[model samples]
Target: MSVLQRLLFARPAAAYPTHVPLTGLQQGALTVLSALGALASPRRADLVAAVGETSAGPALAALRRRMTLDPRGADILAERPRVTDALLRRAAALPPDTFGGAYAAFMGTRGFSADERPPVRFVADAELAYIVTRAREVHDFWHVLFGCHTNVQGEVALKAVEFLQTGLPMTALAVVAGELRLPAEQRAELNRTYLPWALQAGAQAADLMCIPYEKHLEDNLDELRRRYRIIIAPATAGAAARAGSPTPPLGAAPPGFEGLGPGVEGGTAAQLHETSGRLGPV
Candidate 1:
């Protein structure tokens, strides 16, 4: 094939199945266009995915390498699991105190779907592509674990955490763009309250990508947080308290959660526990 033709229509290679390799120029062009689109309309998930995939080669490689060094991550690399609707269904069936239950509530209350995450296309290595896909898929799970809301301030703070965890250029860019768009008061709040918490929580938590989340679906959500050293933002905790669903005290896992599991009257207890502060507001 001619160079131009190859650049325009590169076939998938055996080593990078499902990948559509892009030339450096093409990748750079896509990055710029997608970044602009994403910045202009932050809700355009497709544009955000394009920017992430186009700019993620080096970061993905590094993440993949890191994953291979940990036993659970190595298992993930070998299995190449994809978060699917079936998994979400299973999560939805769990009790509210469980990790999967909280995740399902997080998605349900927000009207978000796991299928909405875009696929990885531009990275030329199969493992790297899988890593990118994994990162995208587990994003909401991160939100659940971190107690971040979908609001601008919360998203920006979570992006900082993501940047710390994955070192992805797209995440860094998102943080910068999010900060630029915030009002002065909110920006100050982010800088004062959320940013410091993100820095501490992101730096202290275990490598999230290595966790076998599917295996831990039945685990207690508070236990999972304790195991992962997750630090919930104070605002999130306060919100939970205001909603009359107080969280377990830091470093202590309380009993029963005030009848907050499944099968509660009207199912309001579960919903309140999940949305008020545990899984974060939609």
Candidate 2:
């Protein structure tokens, strides 16, 4: 492996005495924060700023309560194993267009494709990488569940859900950066269209964090969306692109793009949390 790969896959230099790591409940809390954080797109970070509103602290709590309390979005959460190379392989082998043709249509409309990041062939953490890998792989379904598309706003929403679900630092970064890209109006819309739903969905939905994402290919998208109470916006992105107008704020790309598609280049989640990517399990 290259030096960077070695480092990414290597164990932490030191054990974290206080890290406790996120237990299921703690992760659930972060899921709420991540969800709300994501919704404040173009200002996802601003959403993170909104995280501490004591009166609104219940966001995380709300997420936890929903996951523990409801039965809807939890089935997939059960089949998940900790992140592993084998799991990555399995996810990759499951299907090609499982992310849905809608995702592909979304990308084509934007004139971008995967090729942004080096392939994530190896899961960095033998122990925890499977979790991360699985988390990364299933991310698109999260988009499908929440009616998210590739826009600054959708990324924040998705990242927020990731935070609520996985508590990953990367998701936190996406949520924060996404907010910075938004205008005042978009932020307000997020609070209504995405955040409330995420709070409930992140909390009450089945444990997506633990599910085997590859197994859900035969499942129904509309049914899944209905189960999760997700909304689907019109594909306005294609229109904006055709107009030859200035790029619209956010919603510029398909949902879950960290610049990882076929021919797109340069951007990485590390470089821009408003990143881009293809709809693959990779």
Candidate 3:
């Protein structure tokens, strides 16, 4: 059997999987794909606008009825050519201490030390590729919106929601893989607290990827909560942190990433690892 398969099925005492290394070539490919995805999608800006228009139609219609009117969304609608490179560049220059910076560094700290995550060393071409990439970048905001910590149950809940919303295969993988981290009661709580909410919110709310998250960084969490009809499950915060227990300490400053301090406020530090091993970009 291959080393990875062994690592996958091996029993470890830590209650989570050990870190598995990836070869150099495999790493190179995913980076190329992420970059090419960022570049090749000449329609990226168009797709972003289109997704928002299509996905948010119902939400907008309802919003119009309940609230007087939102000229901001309409203004955004009037402006075509969504999310330009210039815009992304301006966004990058914004403080790294904010949520945006943490997202920018995902491929670095997020995947295994041995294998950098997407747009790192390889890339892929898929439908909704840019949308998928955007979803990955703002994953944490979803947590913040849900008032969730990085616990296994929360991750599973979000993944299940993503699966239902976008039908992304990777999200389904996350749902199944994340299940390994849950204890019996926590798993049950996941089913009760997060599952239905994820389905309803994911289906009902607008396509998050298309929404200009950067614009909302300073927006009141309460306002977002009210509009979306979401609940931050009060089941308890420790559940996710316990799952943070691991064998390999996350390596020192991840490469391909700028050192931004979460302490700096508005900047974020994101860490993504799993029981199976670190998630590689490839």
List, residue by residue over 204-265, the lDDT tens digit for candidate 3. Answer: 76645445666754444445555665544343223224445211112232111221101111
**Top-lDDT structure, candidate number:** 1
lDDT of 3: 0.40
Candidate 3 has a TM-score of 0.44
TM-score ranking, high to low: 1, 2, 3
Error of 3 at 174 (Å): 1.2
Candidate 1 least-lDDT 10 residues: 254-263
lDDT of 2 at 57: 28
How much is the lDDT of residue 27 in candidate 2? 40
Better of 1 and 2 by TM-score: 1
Which residue runs of candidate 1 sit more than 4 Å off their true CA positions?
1-18, 40-44, 239-282
After superposing candidate 2, which stretches have Cα over 4 Å from the reference?
A: 1-125, 226-282
- Output the TM-score of candidate 2: 0.46
Candidate 1 structure, TM-score to reference: 0.79
Ranking by lDDT, best first? Answer: 1, 2, 3
Better of 1 and 3 by TM-score: 1
Please report, in order, the local distance difference test score of every candidate based on alpha carbons. 0.69, 0.42, 0.40
TM-score of each predicted structure versus truth: 0.79, 0.46, 0.44
